[model samples]
Target: MTDMIERSNTPVRRRSPGDPPTVPNHPVGPGRLRVPLLMFGAVAVLVWIGIWIGNTQLTHDAFFPSRPGIAGGTWFEGWQRWDAYWYRTIVREGYVSYPGVQSSVAYWPSYPLLVRSVSWAFPSIFITGSMVTLACGAGAAVALRRWVGEFLPRSAAITTLALFLVYPFGYYLYGAVYADALFVAATIGAFLLVERDRPGWAGVVGIVATAARPAGMVVAVALLLRVIERRNLARAACSPDAAAPGPFARFDPRALRRRDTPVLLAFAGVGAWSTYLWVRFGDPLLFATVEENWGQGAGPATWFKVRVFEELRDKPLAAGTIGHVVQGLLLIGALALVPRIIRRFGWAYGLFTLGVVGLALVGTKDFQSGGRYLIGAFPCFAALAEPLVSRPPLRAVLLMLSLVALFAMAVAYGRGTYLA
Candidate 1:
C-alpha cells in the first residue's frame, strides 16, 4: 500500500550514500509517454461531449433562474453559473465594488489573475477561461497518472486516471469558469514532485496551488508530514535493533532541516494571499467571513441540522432537500474512508486527507459542495480505485456509474444547477 516508485522504464538504480532517491527516470520517448497523452486526450473528449450535450438543453430547471441569452454562448455555454460570473467580473474589471460592501472579496485572486495573465492576448475572457480550464483538466489527469504510476502498475495507473476523468461531479473541473481544474492540476503536480523527492519544486508548485483555493493550504502539512515519516522510516530501516521508549518511536528533528525550508515556502502561499486580502480589504479573513453571507457557518456542526435533517423534515420530498441530504451523506461516506487510506498509505497521506475533509467540513452550510471539495483529496479517489485495479467486472461497474452520473451532472451544471 505504501509502495514507492519502481517502474520498469524508471528502474531504481543503485544510489550512493547521502544521495536522495532518484525518480521519474522514465524517458520521455514516444513509446513511454503515449499512454498518458492518450489519457489526456480522452478526458478532453469526454469533457467536450458533456458541454456539447449541455448546450442543447433548456435552463428552465436551474438552481437559480437565469435569463435567456445570459448563459448561452457558442463556447462553454451555460457553464458559467453564479460563481463563474464573479470570476469573469474579477478578470474583466479589477476588484472594484459599489458602496462599502461587496461579494467579490469572497473569491481568492489566483484564478482570476491567472486568467487575465494567460489570456492577455485573447479578447474574450470566456474563451481564455475555457481554454485554461480544459488545459488544466488534462494537466491534472496527466499528473495524477504519473503519481499513481509511482505506486501501481502502468495499466492500473491508466485505469485510475480514467476513473477520475468521469467521476460523477468531477466534470466541474473541466469547465471554463471554475478554478477547480487549475487547483487540482497544481496540487497533483506539487505532490507528484514530492513523491519524486523534489521538495523544492513541490513547494514552488504548491504556492500556486494554495493561492488557487484556501483548502489547498493543506499541501504544506502533507509535505511536512511526508518528510518526517519518510525520514523516520529510513532510520528504522537502517537500525533494526534500535530500541525505542514505550510504544512510540522518536524521529530525529535534524533529518527534516533540509526539507523544512521548502515546505515552509509552500506554506507561505497562504500567508501571501492573507496579506493581499488585508492590504486590499483591511481584513485578512474577509474571504472566509463572507461565507456567512451565503448562510454558511464555520464548523461541521453547522451542517448537521439546518443544512440536512431540518431541510428533510421541512420538505421531505422536495428535490433540493433530498439532494442536500444525499450530498451530505456522500460527504460523510468519503470522510469515513480516511482511516483506511491512512492505514494503507501512511500517516502523512492520512493526515493530509483528513485536513481536506476538515476544510470541507468547516465554512459551509452543508455538504453542498462536498463532491467538488473531495476532488482535491486525491488520495481518497486512489484508495477507492485501488481494489478495482485487478477486478475487470468491478472496474466496469464503476465506469458505468461514473460515466452515466458524469453526463447527468454535466447537464445539470450546464442548466445552471448546483451540482456540487
Candidate 2:
C-alpha cells in the first residue's frame, strides 16, 4: 500500500514552476495524431470496462489458494489463479516452503513486496493492487512510446501506441491483475534508460522488473549490450604492441578504467536475485518448486505433458491453456517485426528481445495471453506498425483497417471471448 497509496494520497495540485512534470500530460499534438490519440483513449476505456467486468465476475467469495498437501490461509480476493494467487500469499506472509517441496512457487519477490507495502496504506489492498497493475500497464505504454519515438517519425510513434492498444492480445494486461503490465513498463523503462546512456539506471530497473516474474531476465541483455559496446570501442582503439595499446589507450582511460561495470552489474543483479531465492527458501538456483512438487518439472516428459495435455494442469484457465496457443502466434508476429524497429531506430534491442524469449521459455507452460508473455519485448509495437503503414494511400487504408481491428480486439479482449 505504501507504494500505491503514497502516490494517490499526495493530492494532484497544479505543478509549481520548479516542479517536474508528473507524467506525459499534454496531448501528443493535434492533427496527424488525432486518430491515434482517439484510439489510445478507446484503449483506456476498454481496459476500465474489462476491470469492471472482472471485478463483477471474478471476485471470489472465499478464494483460497490451495498448495497441494499443505495447510494454511488460502483465500484472497480478485486474484486467485496462476502467479497472482501465490503472489498474494507471498505478500501476506513472507517466504516459506520455498526451497523444499514448494520451491517452484517462491517467486523473485519485488512486486509482491511492493504490494505488501502498498496494502499497509490502503483500505483494500486487493483493489489497490489491481488498480496499481492497471496503472503500471498504462505507464509502460507511455515509456514505450517515448523510447519508440526516438526512431519512428512522430506520427509513427503515436501510431505505435495506438496499435499496441488494439493489439488482439493487448487486452490481457487489464483482463486480470497480472504482472504483464509492470513487466512491460519496467522493461521499456530500462530500454529508455540505456538509450539515454544511463546504464546504471537500466541495470536497477532490470533487477526490479525481473523480480516481478523472473521476466526481467531480458534486461540482462541490456547490460550485456553495454559490455559489448565498451568492448567494441576498446578493440577499435587497441594497438599491436606495447601491451597492445593504441593512441587513446596511452592517454584516455575512459572506456578502459570501468569497462566491466555493466557486466558486473549484470552478475550482481542476477546473483542478488538468485541470492534472494536461496535466502527465502534455500536452493538459490531452483526458481520455483511449489509449481514443481505439483509437477512443474522442466524434464522432457513433463514438458511433453504440458504441451500435449494443453489445458490448465496447475490452475484454472490461466496461462496453461489453449489461451497460450493464440498468445504464441501473437508473439511470433511481434518478434518478426523487431528487425524493422531496430532499423528505424538504428539501435540493436536484441538483448531486450532475448530476455522476453528467455522468460517465455521459463514460463514452464504457456502464459495467459499475448500481452502477458511476449508483449513486454517493448519494441514490437513500433515494428508491427511498420509492416502495415510505411507509406501512403494504400498503406493508410491498411493502417485504418488495423486501427479498426485494434479497437475491436481491445473490446473483444475485455469481453473475454475468442475467435477460433
Candidate 3:
C-alpha cells in the first residue's frame, strides 16, 4: 500500500541496479493530521449543539416514546433513544431474556461492556456511552484518514474524511449512544492495521469489531480476502512469470501460516459471546434466533419479498418511506462503486462494501437501520472522495445535501422518531 511521492523542487536521484528498493518514510504525525482532526472536532461539536437545540426547542410527536430512565434527563438525552435504550439496559443489567421475547442478547456486548466499565466513574450510562461513542468516532476519523492517505493524496484523504463526517446517517457516529461508533472505529482500525502488514493487531481490533455488531463478521471475511491477496502477491513476486492465482482459486492451507493465524481471533470474539449465551440461556446462537422477534430474518425468501419500492410508491413522503429511499439510494451508490473500489483499493475493500450492503439489505424487512449500517462501508466513501477531490463544486453540493439530511435525521432522532 506504500507509494513514493517526490517532493517538488527535490532533485531525482537515480538508483543502481543493485541498490535496495527505496522504502518510504510515511509518518502519520500531528503535522499531517492537524487540519482534519480539528475539522472533525468542530463538526462533532456542532452536531452535539445541533442535537441539543433540536431536542430542546423543536417538538414532534414521538413515534416511539422514550423509555423510562433511558432518555430525557440531560441536555444530550436526545441521543439516548432506540438502541441506546438497549445499551443502557445492558449496562445496568447484563444480557437478560424472556422466553420468545426480544432481549439484550440481540445487541452485541462490547459496547455495553465498555460503557459499564466506565460507568463506575461517570455514574450515568447515557453520558458514559455518549463519551465512548464520541471517542470512537474520533478514532474512526483518524484511522479513515490515515488509511486513505496510504493510497491517495492528502487532499483526497481529507475529502474522504469530510464525506464520512457528513454522510447523512453519520450523526450516529457523533453523539448517539450506539455500538455503531465503536464498530466503525474497530472496523477501520483493523483495515488500517492490515494495510500496514500487522495481522495480529488487526485481529485484535477485529475482535472488538465482531463483538460490537453482527455485521462485524464482515471485517473478518475482508481480512481473509486481504490475506489471500497477500499470498497472491508473494507468489507473483517469487515466480515473476507464473500467472497469479485467480480470486476464487482453490484454498491453500500453506497460506494460513503463523503470521496469519491471528485472523481466527476475529471469530473468537463472537465465539466467546456465543459460549456465554450457551452457558446462561442454553442457546449459543440466541442472537440470530432473537432477531426473528424483531421481524428480521435472513434468507432468499426475505430478499425476494422486499417491499421498499412498494412503500415508496404508496407513501412517497412518509417518514419510513423517506428512510427507505435514503437507504436505497445509498445502497445503490455503494454498489455502483464496488468495481472502482476493487480497482482503486483492493478486493477486500470492494467485497467488504458488497458484504456490508448485502447484510444491510437482507438483515432488515424494510431496510430498517440500513442507512446506519452502511456507514461501515467506508470504501464507498473513499471511492467517492477520489473523484470529488478534483471537483469542488460537486463536492460542495454533496456535502451540502449530506449536511441538510444529517440535521433532519438528527432532529428526527432527537424526537424519538424511528430513523435508519
Query: Per-candidate TM vs. native?
Result: 0.86, 0.67, 0.88
CA RMSD of each candidate after superposition: 6.1, 13.3, 5.7
Write the residue-wise lDDT of candidate 2 on 210-231 in tens digits: 6666655556655455434434
Candidate 3 TM-score to native: 0.88
Better of 2 and 3 by lDDT: 3
Between prediction 2 and prediction 3, which has the larger TM-score? 3
Give the candidates in order of TM-score, highest first. Answer: 3, 1, 2
Angstrom error of the Cα, residue 266, model 1: value is 0.8
Q: Where does candidate 2 stray beyond 4 Å?
A: 1-42, 54-82, 98-104, 230-269, 288-290, 301-306, 309-322, 338-348, 361-371, 391-420
lDDT by residue for model 3 (195-284), tens: 777888888999999888888878888877776666555544455345545555413446556888787677777888889999999999
Candidate lDDT scores, in order, read: 0.70, 0.54, 0.78
Q: How far out, in Å, is residue 291 in model 1?
A: 1.1
Best model per TM-score: 3
Q: If both were scored by lDDT, which would come out higher, candidate 1 or candidate 3?
A: 3
Candidates arranged by lDDT, highest first: 3, 1, 2
- Compose the digit string of candidate 1's lDDT tens values, residues 52-141: 666565543545454446423534565666578788889978774333355777777778888999887665677677778877887888
lDDT for model 3 comes to: 0.78
Flag regions of model 3 displaced more than 4 Å: 1-27, 63-74, 238-245, 249-256, 299-301, 305-310
